[model samples]
Each structure stands twice: as C-alpha cells, then as structure tokens.
Target: MAVPPALETPESDGDATSGGPEDLQRQSWTRRTFGAVIENPHFRNLFIGNIFQFGSMQMQLVVRSWLVFHITGSFAALGTVALANAIPGLLLSPVGGLIADRAPKKTIIQSAQIYNMANAAVLAALAAGWLGVELAFWHLFLSSFLQGGVNSIMMPSRQSMISDLVPRDRLMNVIGINSSGQTFMQLVGPGIAGFLIAALSPAAVFGVMAALYFFAVTFTMRLPTKPLYAFAQSDAGRAAKQARSGGRRSNGFKDLKDGMRYVATDPTIRMLIMVNFLIVVVAMPYTMLLAGFVKDILHKGAFEQGILQSVQGLGAVGGSIFIASSASKGRGKMMIGWGALLGVGIVAFSISTSFWITLPIMIFIGAAQAGRMAIGQVLVQSYSEEEYRGRVQSVWFMQFSLVQFGTFLVSILAEFAGPQVAIGGLAALLVLAMGLIALFVPAMRRLD
Candidate 1:
C-alpha cells in the first residue's frame, strides 16, 4: 500500500490547517465523529461557551416574555417586547459583520458576552425591584434591544471563527456538533426557565442567566486571539489586507458593499445563500403554527403542546448528530433532500389528525430543518473566500432576521385560509422553490 503524499509530510503548524485555500484540497476526512471537537482545546472552549450562551438566550426569552406579560397584561405589549428583541439584529448585523472582519473574533465574542452579562444583571435587578427602580416598559424594551445588538455581533463572530478551529475535512462534523448542541440547549433552557420561574422567581432566573453569560465569557476568553493558520503571509491574506487598507478602511458601508458584490458575483456562493434564505423564509416558520395545531387541530392543552415541541427538538438533535457523523459527499443533494423533506413533513403534519401520527411527523420535520441548517451553513463556508467569511456570515445572519417577517406573513394568511391550508400552501411553495433552485443553479447542485 502506498502512503499518500499528504500523510508522508504533514504540515508543520501545531494545529495543521487553515480557513482558506490550503484546506480546500483536503482529500480525506477525520474518521472519528467528534475528533475535531474533542481534540481541539480552542474548539472545546467554543463549544462550552456556545452551550452556556444558548441556554441563557433561551432563558432570557422565557423570562422576558413572562415578566412583560405580568407587567402589562396585554398581548400587544408582549409582541412589542419580541419586536424589541428582534429589531437590532435585523438592522445592525451587517455592521456587526464588518466589525468582525476588521477585528479579532475572540475579542468580539468575549466583549459581547460581557455586555450580555451586564445587561442580564441589570435586568435581573429591575425584576427584583432593586434600588427601588420601577420595572417600566422602557427598561424591558431597552434590555431586549441591547441583547439583540450583542447577539447581532456575537453570532457572526462565533460562526466565522469556526473556520479557524479545525481542519477543513472536519468542518462539517464540527458544525453538526455545534448545531446539535444548540438544539439541545433550546430544549433544555426553556424547561429550566419555566421551573426557575415557578419555584424561585423571574428575577432569580435572570440572575442565573447572567451567570451563564459569565460562564460563556470565561470560556471565550481562553480562546486564542489569532487564527492557527498563518494567513498574514499568504497571497490571499496580503490581497485582503491591501483591499481593506486602500481607502476602504475609512467607510463601513464600502466594506459591506464589497461583501454584497462578492456574493452577487459568485455563482455558487450566491446560490447557497439564496437557498439558505429560502429555507428560513419558507420551511422554518412551520414551528410558528405549532400552537394552533396543538390547540385547535389536536384538541390539546399546554402539556400536549410542550410534548410535541420537545419531540421536534429531540428530532433536531438526532438529525444534527446524523449529519456530524457522516462523511461529506453529495452534501448539496442532501441539502435539497432535507429542504424538500421539511416541506413534505409540514404538509403531512397539516393533514394528520391523530396525536401519534403528528408526533413522528414533527420528528421528521425537525430532522429535515436541522439538516438544512447544518448543510446550508457548511455550504456557505465552503464556497466563501476566507477574506470575506465573516461578512458573508453576517449577511446570512441578516437574512435570518427576515424569517420573523415571514412568520408574521404566515400568521396573516392563516387568519383568512385556516392554519392547515396556510401551512400546506407554504410547504408546497417550498418544494417548488427548491426545485427551481436545483434546476437553475447547476453549480450549487453539483457542490460537494
């Protein structure tokens, strides 16, 4: 048996990989499912930090909404709180991405965590009525908006930093692990928040969430400030530096413009972005109608609704683990399959009347959605140039914001056409959109 040339002379760097062209030629993947995440200390920190952060994020959502409802006793006020939480990222994530590209990602991540910690602490105090400060509408609204801004910056930095952690061969596996971890936290955090609020207090839950943010900061602080790959001397690196320094450094909009131009010009990158956006805008919102399905269609209560949601979360974790354990090949086709499956699953669930039937249906729906999320992210990473990775992911984050708008649209349509019909129509549209993407974007379909 002949030893491969790559194995014959492994690169001399300690981590032995880059986020750029050096990794594009990788011919073999790590055999262990979690080899990348397990072996790398930096990534281990990131993984831990992410879990803590996600748990806090979920806790905040529950606590914030609960407290707002208690204070105002109005549904519209609750909607206003959710809007406050969403608006910052919708408007500022591109700017956040630009900051990520120009600054060290670790610094940005840790800084954001610090801000979250402070914000959480203050909000917790207000909830506790500390300093005799009133829990006014503005207080809740301001905290929610600030958290959104912190998230707007933190998300892109964290995601783009993944490219720096492991060998390109292990990228898919790492992403899958991270995605699954997030889904697991989403399942856990809300439950914990509910318990905390019932047993302790909303203020106590916020205080605990603040501690989680601090935990995230502790882990993130240990991450290396510099990328393992020595890109400063590489050709692309030099060009990237030159591109940034030549008057483009003066204006943030120019940097954003360049990122948009790059996405617009690259066929594969553009297609992948569009596909991911479509996935969010269409298939992701099925979860929004879950309450309607459980309450009206299934003739159930909060307990049954919680059961159905938990089933989907479990399925999401299962699906993410499935993707992480597999070797990469036909990733593009798999993405298409997942996207279509999501739509099909939603349509199937819309028609099913039995609790048992809908349970499995939600599982498959969760799996399909999780798979699309993991695959769509990996595709964007693979297609993007290293110079633009942060900015590119920023745009991806921005597109994710529009998903709320899509869900709102779905709610409006559902008012007229019934929930099942509205959901089924969107699912059908998802299938048709994916089919068009596959047909027109041959480069995307052909991606590995």
Candidate 2:
C-alpha cells in the first residue's frame, strides 16, 4: 500500500488542524492521530466500557469452562460450550456488520450490551441456585447464543469506532492501548474468577460478571450520539428499501456472499483474515485444553490452572503495554517479526512438561501474540477505507468465530492423539503458516 500522507496538524483548540505543546500532550493521551478525533468524551466512555465488557466476558469464559467441567467432568461438554458460543457469531456476524454500517453505532453497541446483560442475569440466576443444573446447561447454551449474536453486532462497531475517536497518525497507539487494556483484564479477571470459584460457588462468579455487564451498560448508555457517515447512511437507506420491497433477506447466504466478496477483493484484508484463521485454528484451543492439561497432565488443580492462565495473560499485558508505548516509533515491521517468534514460543510451550518451564514460555507467547495483534490492527484499519471499515472489521470478527472450528478439531485430535501431541501438531501448523505468510505476503512482512 502507498504510504499515507502526513496528517494535518491539530489547531490550538485541539481541533484537527492546529498544533501546540498542550495540543501535543493532549494528543499523546487522547488522539494518537495528528489530526484524528481522539478527545471525544464519547470515545473515552466507549473505551472504558470495553475494559469492563471484555474483562467480564473473559472471566465468565474461564469460570464457565471450570463450572461445566466440575459438574459434568466431560471434555466433550467443554467443547460443546465453545461451539455454542462460536456458531452464532459465525452464522450471523456478516448481517451484524451490515447493521453496524447502516444503524447508529452507539445504539447498536448499547443494544448488544443490554442483550449481553440479560444473558448474564439469567446465568447468574442459575448460578445462585434459582435454577437446576440441567436447566443451567440449556440456559448457558442459550446465553452463549445470545452473546454470540451481540458480539456479531458489537465487534465491528467497536473496532470501526476507534478511528473516529483518534486520528490516523495515532491509530496504532490507540489500538495498542485498547489491546493492552484487554490483556490487562485478561491478566486479572481470570485469577479473580478462579479464586472466587474456588472459595465460593461458580454462581458467584456469574454474579460478578453480571455486575460488570451492568457497569458496561451504564457506560455505553452515556456515549454521545454520533451521526452515521454519508456512505453508511446510503447503505442503510438501500437496505431499508430492499427490506420494503421484500427483496432482501436479513439472514441468508446472500449476506454472507456480500461479506465474502468484500473480503476477497482486498488482498491485505484477505491475507490478514487467513492469518487470523490460522492463529485461531492453531493457537486458541489451548485454553479449552488447559484445565485438562492442569488436571490430567500436570497433576495440578484449579488454583494452579488459574495461575497458568494468569501467567499467559500477564505476558500479554506486558506485550500490549510495550506496543502501546512504542507503536508511534515506527517499528510495525519488527512487531510482526516478533509475532512469528511468539508462534515459536507457543511451540516451546507444547513440548514443556513442567509448570516452571511452561510458564515463562506462555508469557512470551502472550507478548508475541499481543504485539502481532496490535500491529495487525493498525495495518488493516489503515489499509481499509471508511466506506468499508465495518465490513472489513466483520471479516476479522468472522475469523475469530471460526476459531471454534479449530478448537473443535484440536479437541477431537486431543481425544485420539492426546493433548500434548495435539498441541505440538498445532504449533507445527502455526510455524508452517508463518513461513508461508513470510514468503507470499510481502506487504504483511513489510508491515505496510
């Protein structure tokens, strides 16, 4: 891609074109872009809201897996729960992306949060002993489905909104900070959930998650209303017209086809999608198998499991902070190189037999993953036009949903080949993927 033109200097009022020392400092904290929209209170609310939202989501994920395993003692059940969460997003996310472009983003995000809150409330009730375990499974599955739908809507809006919050120059930094916050939450939330589950009931964890969702809801509600861009408004009008004419299907293969077409035409985005798919397919399932790794392989229990998970998250937090601090220094290419190194670290993780050995490797893996993700976001957002930003983001989210497929495949492999072998195989696949991307996608390699 061509190097983007330099951003115009911001004005003294911290507006998009004038510049000064105070403006620079404010830009450092809020904008990240030379001429971007960083200082908006609305964006700050959204960013803060995301911390609680993503943190709660992560906590519930760890807690739910543990709870289900504790109750059923079945790896298959754990896989099934993952499937429940993944399928809806995979199926519905494209439509959600279209909606995000056409509808008001803040409203879309708020509605999704409300739906998410409801899901958590139901789960909390089940955890509090107001519902039966059998009923809990059904509720959990339903809630996962709902959450998946919400994510389909929420992910694109949240991602695309960042550019609107900060300028092009600071986009990389903002993404880094956003990712760092996510990693920070991952570092703390799991440990908290694990401790709570160990001391109290699993239901208590759910209750905590519900409270976090409530907080997110409050913050999201406070977001300032921003008008849709002209292209977005046009798309919305077209969609409405099609709906009125009975010519459009909200949920169908056609919507998926449109999304696929958008992704197919953009080479950078296509490569990014493929890489994301590979990562999810190869790396993410380790979380699913972690509890088993702790119990059956490592001969440890819940506390150790939590520590193992927390260590990886700590690594991610460290990585994210590093990226956030230095992204503006123009080392995007180097960061991608480090991401490949992270894959190597994950491979090392698979071969290790002891916690002492695995912990440090996992931390490095986290750092590498975060760095790659931060840089990758910068590349994708920079390359994509505002007209298709939501659609591009949806494609990215779809890769995440499809990661469940990888997880399921790996889970089955674990049953037949064992977790160690399965993980090792995934590591090899990731290395192979890295090599291929390095050879074929020079743009990605150059971090342009």
Candidate 3:
C-alpha cells in the first residue's frame, strides 16, 4: 500500500509566505517555531483557552492528591480516588467521541467547560464549610468521580479539534506546541496551588480553579462554529465514510461499533495504541502516587511536593519545544527512546532520598513524558482516518483508566512492599517493554 503524502513532510508555509531574506530575518525565533499555528485566530483562541483549562487541572491534581493523603494517610485511599476518576472515563469516553463526531465539536467543548466550572464552584462552597457540612473523604471521592466524567466527555472533542484548525502537515508542530502550553501550566499551577493550600485553605484552591474554568469556557465560545463533520481527505477516510453512507446518521451505538471495528482492523493504529497503553500503565502511575511518595520517602510536605512538580514541568517545557522545532522523521523511534529515558529516570527517582537529587530526576522524567505524549498523539492522529479520529483519540484516552487501575494495584503493593519497590519495579517493566517493542514491532519502528 502506498502511504499518503500527509504521512510525509509537506511544503512549508514559510516557503510560500516569506517575501525575501529580510522577511525571514524579521520573524522572531518564537514566531518562526510556533507562529504558523498560533497566528490562526481560531487556534489562538483555543490555545489561550487551553492554558486556563490546563492550569486548573494541574492545580487540581496537586490539591486533590494532597487533600486525600492528608485526610486518610492511606495509599489505598489515594488509589481509590484515582479509581473514582477513572471509572467514568472508562465507560463514557467512547460515547463522548461518538458525540464529537456527530455534533458541533465547539458546542460539545463549551458545554463541558461550563459543567466543570459549576462543579468546581460547588466544591469550593463545600470546602468553605458554608453548607455547615463537614467535608469527608466520600465528598472528595464523589467530586472526583463527577469531574472525571465531564473530562472524559470533553477531552475527545478538544483533541480532535486541533486537526480541524490546522493544516495536516503542521499537526506535529501544533500538538507539540500545545503540549508545551500544558507543561507551562504544570510548572506554575501546582506551586501556586500548594502555596494557597498552605496559606489559606483547600477552598481557596477550588475557587481559583473555578475562575480558570470560567475563562476556559469564555475562550472556547469564541471559536467559530464548525459543521458536525469535515470532508474526508484520505483514501481510507473516504472509504470509511462511504461504507456507512446509507446510515451516516445512525444511532450513536452503531457509530461507536463502526469506530471500534475500524480501530481493531488497522495494524498501524493498533500497534501505536498498544505501545502507548503499555507505557502509560507501567510508567505513568508515579504521578498519581507521588504525594504519598513525597511524604513517606522524602519527608516532605505539600510545599516541597509542589516544587518537585514544578521542576518536572520545567523539563517538560523544554522537551516540547525541541519537538516543535524537530524534523518529522523517525518520530516513532524517538518516542520509544523518550519512554525508555522516562523509565530510567523514574527508577533513579524511586531510589533517591535527597530532595535536591530527586528534583533533577523529576526534570528528566518530565522531558521524557512530554516527548512520549506529543509524539504518540501526533502518530495516532497522523495515521487515523478523519471519520474515526475522535474515536481513535477516545481509545487513546482509555489508557488513563488503565493507568489508574495500575495506580490502584501499585498502591496495594506499596501497602506491603513499600513505595520504593512498588514504583521501581514498574519503571523497570516499562524500560523492558520499550526495548521489546523496538526490536519486534518493525512496522511501528518504520512509521515515518
């Protein structure tokens, strides 16, 4: 089968637009790297909105995990909170993607944002004790479950819209730059959240999150309303569209089934998803468990924990920039290399007791995570047909549920084996898994 030109490098927009050497020189370094996508009015709005969206989320992670551990001092409880968040995504993400394919994605995204803002407001009230109800573990758990459901529904449309706004060839740069924005929030959101939690209360953090969520909704509302679906561009995309032409407006379940079949039958997509899933399950749980790890191992509190996350985000920002500027060849190999480095960093982090030493290791882990995340999404979207793109992304998101399950199990292991062994063992497994994939998955290695 002949690969489409979309899979290779396409003509640079710069080549056509640059008037002369003077014009090229006038473009700032930042403009040269990201101006292509950010300059789009629609992309600019979405990008700015995502900064607020991601900021709230990063802050919530720190606040929530710290609250859980502070309340129960049990690793199992932290895992349970993660599980609460994951279960809804496990069940509703596919349906969310189906809706994205059939509805105006902007509407779907804005609705979810509004829902999150309200949810955050309620949590803020509850935490403030204005209701005269003492906060309990179940309150946090229930809040997490509801918030997770909304996120599962929201993420597919948000991710799929990136391709809609940009040219196909710019997908890598756009996704990389988007990830950079996310990492930028990761750098500061948690540190600020930690400070607020220490200085005021958890209620303060929730209030800030609500404000950020409101801004996210405002920016999303500015995006031009698009049609329910775009025209299919790839040969496979056209074939998939035609196959379901008679029932193009069929019920959601049927559309979902068709999407699942498409994914199951495509070898390249299956491999890409498998590699990503395994890496996520084995290597990603450390973040979920880090709160406990910090207190127990590093003898730290909320403030130090947040600082570590900020350092990790610092490395991640750098990694995403490198990807944004990089050549679009051998991305598959590069992703695997990053995953391996992440595993190694996690292993080093697991054994380290000094906070200073762990800071640098966290930076290493963050860089690796940024590369793996940006490259994986780019590959999956690059290879999938347009009609199935949302479904593909939802499936990609299903890994979150699996990783939460992995966190739950590791938490149990930590209960018996200690955090060091529980986390280190999984990191080792990730390193081994990446090596095997590189050696055996020839098609994946040859993706570009």
**Per-residue lDDT tens digits of candidate 1, residues 134-211?**
778788888888888888988888998887766555677789989999999989998999999999998899899999
Highest-TM-score candidate = 1
Give TM per candidate. Answer: 0.91, 0.83, 0.88
Each candidate's number of clashing pairs is 0, 9, 0
lDDT of 2 by residue, 154-229 (tens): 8988887776555565566567778888988988887788788889978788888878888888988876565412
Cα error of candidate 3 at position 363, Å: 1.1
Indicate whether candidate 1 or candidate 2 has the larger lDDT: 1
* Candidates ranked, most accurate by lDDT first: 3, 1, 2
Q: Among all windows of ten consecutive residues in candidate 2, which has the lowest summed lDDT?
A: 3-12
Q: Which should have the higher lDDT, number 2 or number 3?
A: 3
Model 3: residue 397 alpha-carbon error in angstroms: 0.9
Task: Give the C-alpha lDDT of model 3.
Answer: 0.82
Q: By TM-score, is 1 or 2 better?
A: 1
Worst 10 residues of 1 by lDDT: 1-10
Strongest candidate by lDDT: 3
